[model samples]
Target: MNIVVDAFWDDEAKVWVASARDGIGIATEAGTMEQLQQKLSIIVPDLLAEDYQGPFEIELIARSHQTVAAA
Candidate 1:
C-alpha cells in the first residue's frame, strides 16, 4: 500500500503538521520535518489492518511559505 502524506509548516502554531487524504486516518504535528517523518513510520502500521502484510511505502508531500525581505 502506498500512502500519501501532506505536510506544512504552521507559522502560528510553530510546528510542522502532517495530514493525509480521507481514509488514510493520519493527522499529526511535530516541531521539525525529521520528527514528523519519524512519527509517520510508527503511526502508519498501527492504522493498517492486522492482516496487512509487511512492506508499504509512504509519499510525503510538503509545502511551505515564507517572506524574505531584500534577498
Candidate 2:
C-alpha cells in the first residue's frame, strides 16, 4: 500500500504542515520540511494501523506558496 500526503508552508504559523491527500484524514505540522517528512514516516504507519494491517508505502506531495513584493 502507498500513502500520499500534501505539505504546505504556513507563513503565519511559521511551520511546515501536511495532510493526507488520499483521504487518510491526517494532518501534522513541523518547524521544517525535513522534520515534517520524518514525522510523516512515523505518523502515517501509526494512523494506518488503526484500521489497516500489513506493509505500506508512503509518498508525500508538498506544496508551498510564497509572496514577493514588487521591487
In order of appearance, the predictions have TM-scores of 0.86, 0.81
Q: lDDT (CA) for every model shown?
A: 0.88, 0.84
- The prediction achieving the highest TM-score against the true structure is 1
List the pairs of residues colliding in candidate 2. none
Q: What does the lDDT read for residue 44 in candidate 1?
A: 85
Deviation (Å) of 51 in candidate 2: 3.4
Q: What's model 2's overall lDDT?
A: 0.84
The alpha-carbon deviation from the true structure for residue 6 of candidate 1, after best TM-score superposition, in angstroms, is: 0.5
Model 1 agreement with the true structure over 1-71: per-residue lDDT tens digits? 88899999999999999988756679999999999999999988888858477576888999999999995
lDDT for 2 in candidate 1 is 83
Candidate 2 matches the true fold with a TM-score of: 0.81
